[model samples]
Target: MLVEGIKSRPVYHGIAADPRARRHIFVLEGEGARALLEQEPSLTPAILASTEILYVARGSAGEGHVEALSALGADVAWTAPTVETLLFRLKAMLAVAHMGTRLYISGTEGFIGKAMQVALDQGMDYSTIPTEHRGSLARRVQCVHCKGVTEDVATTPFTCSHCGLSLLVRDHYSRRLGAFQGVCIDAEEPGVRPEPEALFL
Candidate 1:
């Protein structure tokens, strides 16, 4: 989420040397990812010093990114237990729109796409600005016992139906299911059980 009413500065002599210009940039990191913002390392220190540097954490990675941003001297806030539900995503979009700042979204294509749509709906005029994208770790769950993909795992715990193996949700599974898979667990097996810890590459 970005702070509203941020102004964009112009580059001069191949450098953005203006120090008085205050810009609010929002960074969106995936479930287990972090935004370094190091490519523009020169601007990083200033970005950290800005009054409104908003970072949106959607998954397991949200906490870590928030911590890192704080270390950089950013005024940070974390929205936890996130918009895990579909309805929550809509609410989040509304909240983001009301914030009223130039949005700079960075994350998986799917996440960025949905957020951009909401920004557009709010009449933010982000049509000309290109969105920054980053890759996210795939969502995966381990099922040592079963190998079949079924659609009835949610009502029941994800366990191996055939061998009673516990299921563990791993970030690698994101590759198979796509970026948004972890947003919600649609199904699971009978014996598969969720892992206590989640890993993000």
Candidate 2:
């Protein structure tokens, strides 16, 4: 149980726990992540004041969330992380291992997978802070065209009825599906390839 009186108001338990967090940085992504952060104004500022925060905006199309965060006085450093950037961030996180830093990530499944792999490669203890615990919805990938969001379906076909222009779905299943016997028309790339049904599993 944690309690704090700030400006004569009792602080939430989550806020009280921020000081105990050893991680010097928190990574944020996805739309849900931004919404949650917006809801908890105190926690964001508290976390920033106590430690550093890394904002990964890969796959996010707009700057609204980033702008709002900056307005909140969050000391965030923004970066568009590629596969190579992922490796670099991982290395940086591991270099501070003795400090017992924690990482908070919110993004598409692909981004999450890469981030988790990096954390595991560095031997860092990784945990998913529930939306309730962190006061945010779990991360999700939204279709670039339809805006359909979910974690159940990893692949999003980008032929949108609205725009009719082929939009690229970040972390599209074809990239993860690899080579298979069945046929697949890649959203990011033109052309069809044999993709096995069992290969998806």
Candidate 3:
């Protein structure tokens, strides 16, 4: 998880079943399914019937909980083989989603950001959606120089996936880009790089 007090960090206020919602859309990845599963007690049979669950069983923090997610009996519980497939399905689902639909997302920070990006693109106000952070704390980082995005960054002083420069992952985040900022760490000295730290995993 990112350090507290980072002003740009998205605050996850957790998710709950909106009793009045006619359609409930849950997008989850890896161990994030637990965020929805744990709320079974709060979900009524009718609410569960109207719910649609999309889960990615494999990711940075896979828990092999596809069977468990299916057991929840959401009307359209489907597990995608990959994240790309999941996003494709999610976009389609959101396109025809009704007015009373409520979007909920849970996953690693990277997955959360990506899902939120999709929701935002579909004209959903991010502030109205409920989000829960779960599983790996690995970050999605963007190199300032080449502007290439590197996913699942668990260490500090990592090499930029786009540029060859060594980078220091910063706490500053960009919700629009859905990534954390990574700056060249050895720009001043050119060759001096610190030991990598496993700060987010």
Candidate 4:
């Protein structure tokens, strides 16, 4: 878990198997969690015995995994189609979630960010949450000018879909916004522009 320099990507460690933890909430999206489970078969029984798993997945990729999880006698809940609906469901779940609950999140950066936002809103501490970054590195950006969120923004120096401003996605991440701050690249000079560069490279 040693992060090197300022430019380094966040390094995430594996979730610890804490026997003392009373209630577990496994929030998983996509194939990452499933792959982890497959790699460590023993983890499934332990998870099933104590956790209430909420899975949010799109389409057939998750179908077989969901069935397998169900067969293991897991207390599972599949979220509705969209991320917004899933967030809503998570909010309702967190309304009654107690202190002993532990959160294990596995998904894309944006998906995990959204889930983490909900957890943070519910006052869940970072120590109680362990996330495994999976899927794409694509970021979700929020436009400061219009307060609009641009989802899965793969690159920077792009036009903001909301305010129609050419934005420079900053490295600074906002947990509250669940995105990097996107500022107008040409705001200072008005007509001047900076050449686009690869984001997070």
Candidate 5:
């Protein structure tokens, strides 16, 4: 979820859990993965066949689901993996992945975008990859002043971790920067401050 919520953002259509896909890659992040499995019941059997399930969990949140999916004869792996590692692995997989492969992804907005970027780099089209977004409303904010960026920012009017200045998170997102722009909130009027509003609350 982002500021205006999932509906306002680009939507991802999910592949039904049926075993229609010759090769299936499932990327599930966080506890919300359970919902995905439940929604697409056929996905379970697909996982048992040629599906590769990549699950990223925070702490113990993904443990139970991972176990259940694994027990059902699905090849499931879990982690709170770094973007570099995930991207590297995805690149390696894409190098050998074929045309009939289907990608089912679900996670926070940033995670989905990061994964989609990798998929696009590998020449995978939107029709081959269906996505479902879940979880928190955090922003990956980029600081224009120091050319530094931050992720998982819970709200606007936050201080920049890189530049140590109060910044206001903007609605605009830069795919090249991999974050939304966060400009100095009071740059226009030195002493003037706007009333704070809780975003996505």
Candidate 6:
């Protein structure tokens, strides 16, 4: 089962523009574009003029997000076919980001974690970054045994994509690994394993 009480599960305060910031950087994915779209009413010309939006529209929900986000009229409004492409660009930007720059990420849990990790790699303090949950409840899971990570995992007792073992998804999340822990389910019983359950979705 997906337990929300896990201490490490991130808390999203939604995506809001920091009016005092000299620049704004938005890293969005899928339905996450909506979070930023909702901020239009609060966005001033000065803020939009210095805003950079990177969006991806391949989420479980939302449609025509690409066109919608591009029309936001930010200084840099770009869309990538996938999250990987967006992260590459984000990393380059963060490397030389100036002071007073604010980073905001909105999307599925998996997307948020991966994007957050990228910002952290560049020495950005994640606690200062604002994030919002906007899409699927799917998770990024890492097999404790093989140390292999599986993305968008929405089920419990799911097979680990790497080691081919039936794994029980744990509520335990690892910020350093950017994934939830999955331990082998039938390790003790060998051939016995419970049926898969769609818990995280």
TM-score per prediction, in order, is 0.43, 0.49, 0.94, 0.81, 0.78, 0.94
Tens digits of per-residue lDDT for model 5, 1-201: 124542324555643554566777777767546645675445455456777777767423636876665555665454436555766777778889986777777777677777777888777775567777677767677899998888788776877899877778777676545467788878888646565556732
Candidate 6: C-alpha RMSD to true structure equals: 1.6
lDDT of 1 by residue, 7-115 (tens): 3211112112134445444545553224444433555665555524334565445346666655655544333344234224544644654342344555554455455
Model number with the top TM-score: 6
Worst 10 residues of 5 by lDDT: 1-10
Q: Note the Cα lDDT for every prediction shown.
A: 0.41, 0.42, 0.88, 0.70, 0.67, 0.89
* lDDT computed for candidate 2: 0.42
The runs of at least 3 residues in candidate 1 whose Cα sits more than 4 Å from the true structure, single-residue gaps closed, are 1-21, 31-33, 44-46, 51-63, 83-100, 137-201
Candidate 6, overall lDDT? 0.89
Query: RMSD (Cα, Å) of candidate 1?
Result: 13.0
Better of 3 and 5 by lDDT: 3
Runs with alpha carbons beyond 4 Å of true place in candidate 6: 2-4, 60-62
Candidate 5 residue spans exceeding 4 A from truth: 1-8, 12-19, 44-47, 59-63, 75-84, 126-128
Candidate 2 TM-score versus the reference: 0.49
Model 2, residue pairs in steric clash? 23-101, 23-102, 181-196, 182-194, 182-195, 182-196, 183-195
Q: Tens digits of per-residue lDDT for model 3 on 1-201?
A: 335687988788898989999999999988788899899888888999999999888653445478777888889899888888999899989999889999999998899889888888899998999999988889999999999999999999899988788988999988878899998888989989878999998
Q: Which of 3 and 4 is ahead in TM-score? A: 3
Candidate 2 residue lDDT tens string, 1-201: 112332321112221224566554545554424633554545655566554445555556475766655555545455545545655765686666655455555444444445555666666653433211222222233344444433322233333334344333332232222111111235456644233121111
Q: Work out how many backbone clashes candidate 2 has.
A: 7
Model 4 C-alpha lDDT per residue in residues 1-201, reported as the tens digit of each score: 112253523345655445667777777777545634553455556656776667666523735766665555655646456767878888898889777777777777777778989999988875567888766677788888998989877767878999889988776667776676788888878858767666542
Worst 10-residue lDDT window for candidate 4 reads 1-10
Segments in model 2 whose C-alpha atoms lie over 4 Å from true places? 1-17, 32-36, 44-46, 81-83, 127-201
In the range 130-158, model 6's lDDT, one tens digit per residue, is 99998789889999999999998988989
In candidate 6, the residue pairs with backbone N, CA or C atoms under 3 Å apart (3 or more residues apart, or in different chains) clash, namely none
* Cα shift from native, residue 74, model 5 (Å): 2.1
